[model samples]
Target: MSIVDTSQKQRGRGVLEGAFQVLDALSRFPDGAGLSQLSRACELPKATTFRLLEQLVELGAVQRHGTEYSVGHLMARLGENWQPHPRLRRASRGPIRTLARLSTAAIAVTILDGDRVRVVGATRGTPGELPHVMADSASVSRTAAGQVLLASQPRRERPEAYTATEWRRLRSRLRQDDAVVVEYEDVLPGVCCVAAPAPLPDGQGVASVSALIIGSTVPSALPGLVLRAAGEISRGLAVH
Candidate 1:
């Protein structure tokens, strides 16, 4: 399709068609595609293609190198989570609820969405109250769930979430295995969160299983529960 679908405007599609065209073209080249290449591939003017790419980059759906753009962290996660295979949301539902009940804490299954963590599955900590809403996304350098997923990534693949010094400090605290358990008490002032990694076959954490408890001190058993729950989910994903 041509890059900008002018007819889409009349149909009230907004700018989505232009954005999709850019992403569709970028997905064809694993190493990335230059501005001119993408423009030609999408059959759009260079300036129009550049504007679309800029917006996609801002949304974390596309990454820009020196002159080329490619599928970004968020898009890559979506591909795994929403396309051609079952995702953590399905495999983690039962395990997360069980953990929530056992720990009396909120449980969430999260994956990296750009520099932030995107919660895909959540079980309430209590009967009626919602856990702290993550809104668009949570900081990768701060939250327990975010940190676990960040730690799962290779040291060389630094997303813009953390600076060099910050990454260095955080990286030291990372566990070497996918079955990691980490606790953070100050993420939400009076709250504490503990997270564990659910590893994929590639040895990277496909998602994090986390428990949010309302207290300064985390329950000693909660960490073990989180780890086991994450492991259960990981095992399920492996065979699928």
Candidate 2:
């Protein structure tokens, strides 16, 4: 290719990357942020950030409110339509609701997305409207559902959440036991979680089901209930 052609292609790629950086930074500010805040967060120059923001706003990927900017309705619409694993999401909904009702706890269906765990489905609220513990995305090392998904990955493919030896041991145990329980102290003082893998027909675990219990003590049956729910989801997948 000609040098001019190559240069033009590189510039096009750079523009796309810069625009994505602006959008990613904006996502962290749910309530919206000013131009300066977004510029600093994205580590881009003010002029460049402003230009990208303007283009994004024009494209309907971002919304501007006087001086503040936030993710737009277009992005929300796209996210709502994104079904990475339609069958898994569809099959897990009923089981997640059933488990939540049975355990009186919030439930989440999580899947590995890039380097993070994404909540594909979740129970909306409990009896008193307790806050949902799982966000749209969570750390693979910190959450029980994330741990189950990480355990299935090869050591080399895993994120650096633990020391090499610790990761090896943890993965081995999770693979053997096929479940995990974690208690939170700092982040959610009175919360605990139980998770199990929802495997596909070939025994490949594609997702995890977790229950978020709000209390100091976890009922002994909670883990079993979570496991049963995971099994139901797996069976549902097999049938499809």
Candidate 3:
């Protein structure tokens, strides 16, 4: 009997193996990794590593900074938008609803999308009345998630490049640790939000989980609930 050719199978596995190697190399240096570093870490030839890195960059999964590469924010946005991993939602969504139900508030999950953050998921407390929701990529009012997520960012990250109006809007949302807990900037009128960042494996915040309780609702429990959810998410993603 003739044996089937295993060369094609090996090649297919080789492609994925090389990709994973590149990612692993990039993960080691959160700031970014140069071609040489990636090649050494992956134990692959420089030419081979470069080829893989170039492909990853073009896919928007990795960003090249000068001679180095960093895990691009675009990838985070995509993951938050539609991660096949249930652990993320399991660790976050239930807690979000817990907060919303606690104050009968609306809850929102947002992720940074390029220049602005976009709402990926939301749960409203009551029927008929919808929570404030603006179009995608617009500046959302400061809330729990924004504050925590932004605060989770590096202090040096600049928000000054935006337009005067945009700058003012973003600045207004800024908080301790660069957090942005905004009022009804654009989404959810008559609701005040409290935000915090959901921690990720590499000190990166995966998303902003915020609670938007009715302006008239007492905020006594809102803060604790949001913070608790943030904690849970952080702990859950500790291994990421």
Which predicted model would earn the best TM-score?
2
Best by lDDT: 2
The local distance difference test score of each candidate is: 0.73, 0.77, 0.63
Task: Give one digit per residue, the lDDT tens place, for model 3 in 1-240.
Answer: 123457777787998899988887887787887899889999999999999988888888799889988887766686445643345655666677777777687777666544355554467432111234421223432344543444345552433323557544454544334343545434566666777666556554457777765674446666667767767766766654
**Prediction 1 TM-score vs. true:** 0.56
lDDT of 2: 0.77
Q: Over the stretch 121-173, how does candidate 1's per-residue lDDT look in tens digits?
A: 77843221123343223343467776777756765455465677866766665
Residue runs of model 1 more than 4 Å from their true location after superposition:
1-19, 22-85, 124-139, 156-173, 178-181
> What lDDT score is found at residue 77 in candidate 3?
80
TM of each candidate vs. truth:
0.56, 0.62, 0.46
Off by over 4 Å in 3: 1-81, 84-86, 116-121, 124-138, 141-144, 155-157, 160-188, 216-218
lDDT of 1: 0.73
Tens-place lDDT per residue, model 2, 156-182, is: 354465666866776786676445545
* Candidate 2 TM-score over all chains jointly: 0.62
> How do these models rank on TM-score, best leading?
2, 1, 3
